[model samples]
Target: MKEIIQINLDNEMDLILAHKRCMKIAEMCGMPSSFQTRFSTAVSEVARCAIAKGKNSLLVLGINIIKSTQKEIVAIITDSEDLKSCNPEAFNYAAKISGHIQYNYFDNQFTTTISQQVLSPGLLTETKIKGFIDYFKYEPPLSPYDEIRKKNIELIALSEKLTESENKYKQLANTIPILICVINERNNVLLVNESLENYLEKPLLTFERKTLTHFIHSADIDNVLEGLKRAKQNRSDYIGETRIKKGTNYIWHLVSITPNKAEDGTFNSWLVYFVDINAQKMIVETLKDNTELKMIQLELESANSQLRFKNKELQQFAYIASHDLQEPLRKIMIMLSRAGADLTEDQKKKFYFDRITLAAGRLSNLITDVLNYSRIENSEQYFEEVDLNKVIEEVLGDLSLIIEEKSAVIKVDQLPKVSGLDIQFRQLFYNLINNALKFNSGNPAVTIGYGDIPNDPNFTGSAEKYDVISVEDNGIGMDSSYSGRIFDMFQRLHERDQYGGNGIGLALCRRIIENHNGLINFSSKPGVGTTFWIYLPKNKRS
Candidate 1:
């Protein structure tokens, strides 16, 4: 069904327009004069009944396809009011005239449809229907009375809206607790609410000759005026805290000023509100005068900071230990069970024993890593002259099994010695190399080398010339957008089931680098690879 025209049956004038529109549409559909009169009469009768018995009655005329080929002119009348018990005489009359009428009631609303078969369905083509729509939209009324009636309806609607707006403004100004003042664009006060008059202890008429800044304290008057000036120039709202004069004393109040724009996009006036903040001000003053209270607050803040740091360290330790230990423990249990079953085969028993040893070794390494992570978190470890080359070697040895399983390649250049915690550096490379091996789709090729630091604007390190080491990989890379938050705790780009281990590897690397007064960053592209750049300060410190 395609609706061409709709009319709100608000008054007798609308009913006449509905009937005329129905008849004209019927004629346009190639109906004979007799059928057009009958269809129009039936639609008008139903519309009249709906208007009399219902609220917000609407009539729509459209073309509906029947049985895929036949076309008929349909008129639907809907209203918000329930008509279950209303008289059905009009519906019956419409059905007799049009031969098809449907009345439906749902959700306390009713709709009545009246359809008339087109005389020549082929004549009512798409072009013809569009022509009908354009005619009803742009064509002049058949009589002068209709044009006058439409103008009158528009005037009535505008008047009602203006009345409603005035009533709302009055209700809000008189009832709200906050003080309100209306000022013109010239900053001259035009109106003051009763609350404002009471706060000033003066009559409302006295404000007519005063400026908007009259009630503000001298110390805050300039700021309030500047804010209002900017707001007026930009046609935006202004909010600031200022001291307002109440009786004989000045009290702090949050002032908000909003510009009122007219229909032509010009500012006419401004509405200013003052809300009391005296209680909040008193509390702030009391706090400022108490030295013991300030000391207690500082101590409490420091304690909270330490507590949060410890809690985070414990959480990471618990999660990483539990997550990494599961794999090794499962392997050890499976190897023991297999060895128990195949005690007669010496070769199989040796393989099971080797697997158990490897699992135990991995479990021990994980425990040491977790412990080192806690020490690094607490800044308990002292820095020494650390050999990066040896650290890389140890990390490679720790990840030897995964590297061999994945047929991975590791390329290394001469890494410079730096003053840092050895255990932390080992854990950093362990995580980076292990990730390179684990997240690869095929054989992983990782290159660990040092280079001159790139002049990146986003780098925030304080080093003039630092040791810049890069760990590049040929693995499944992530989106570059995740680079910002890639080092956040527990932030994983891939699902755990797809990739193993908890999402704390990169976070730990970042924490260790920060502890050494350095920065760690990465660049990645999906399907290409990722390269992590580490910037370490050259200066030595305790």
Candidate 2:
């Protein structure tokens, strides 16, 4: 069997196309006009049924050899849907007209085939069947409502002319360095030179029949179209510069369009040329200014210096305010302790003295966090070689009281020595381990380990290699949505009654990591657990 044409039986257009293709193939097989009409109608009936009831339906026309001296014109319709479900009248009519019909179902697919014996089997030689295949392969499909016969004749003529012209210019176009294009008067590209194809990083088939605006940048399209329109009106040449796309980038090109005329001096087509000008354009842009750039740099430096001075002043003010507030808070705590000694339990409940003490303690913690956050900026000068194992040991000892209360299990892996402030590292681990025990329901489990650093683009540090340490716990985790602002100052995700903190721990942690030229991040789930990953540079910055 030699398949001649295939059409997707999707809509009315495909049904009409299937009918025309069947008739054309039958006529090509030396069948009379009466037989062609009957065969085509038979195929259309099955095709219409397939389009109505089937999924991904297809119609194929082929020539099947029945015997050495016998041949048949065959039409096959295949679909994902079972043909038995379709109206049986379509198949009966096809069988009545074509005299032979078969329906088969296999591998979850349905196929309905119809065949009719050709009038002259010997006329359809092997060479003639091959010619039929080649013709259908290159012939573009036409709509049923279009002037099908007229358009077919026109296309054949145009194909001959294009062949002749391509042969004449193929060598010259490929040999030239400049990009060239030949377009009809209607702006449809007839041919594009090899240079244009190579420059655009695409094939000639992609550019053929497409207008110049297809390859031009969106911002420069209007100007290029206007130039073409004006050239068409004046019947003259056009020269302009625009950006043409090359792969993913658009490069500036100087375009020249010259009108091509016949012997009667009537314009028929256009000869277009493109010269690259991106490098020249960049040079011109770079040489346009220098004094303004220097002035802008100086202004930026001055502004940055003033910003540094203001930040220092703010830090000092915060330190002084927190120091002064602590003294009064300490006095309030002492007075509350002395008064609690004299008051009965019932009297203390009535006066709310215990709540007052708790509030004062929370305020003290807030002041202390503020003081610590301010102190980190000045502590960077105290950088030294710090043993992380020792830091973890100290933090664990400090948190042992709560760990014992919660029955927390602590797992510690071997840690590396890194260049950072020892006190900050100690505080970092203390807060992390304390929170691990504090936030759990009961019987907390905490694991501390170090591993190879991951390649994270968001790590804003100049480290060749990093020591990545992780502190994970089996405690209540936070929502991932709050991850972005978790390190922001005073960002509290839970109410104070639910979780007690000054809402500055993560912010302080981030600041300390910045001082050590490191990064800190965490991942968490609401009921599962939270893990904090710290990336510390192996070497200290000068």
Per-model CA lDDT versus the true structure: 0.80, 0.82
**TM-scores of the models, in the given order?**
0.37, 0.46
Worst 10 residues of 1 by lDDT: 204-213
The RMSD (Cα, Å) of candidate 2 is: 18.7
> Tens digits of per-residue lDDT for model 2 on 1-542?
88887677778877877888888888888889999999999889888888888899988889898875899998888899876566798888888988888999888889888898987888888899999999787666564443554466579889999999988778887878888998886576788888898888866453112677679897677667778889999997889998989889999999999998879988888999989999998887688678877886788678667857887788778878887999999999999999899889999999999899999999999888878877876422666788889988888888878888777899999999888778888878887888888788868999998884444334544345677888889888889789888888888888888888977888888878866756787878888898888877666633
Which stretches in model 1 have alpha-carbon errors above 4 Å? 1-375, 455-457, 460-463
Tens-place lDDT per residue, model 1, 19-73, is 8998899888888899999999998888877777878898889999675468999
Q: Best by lDDT, which number?
A: 2
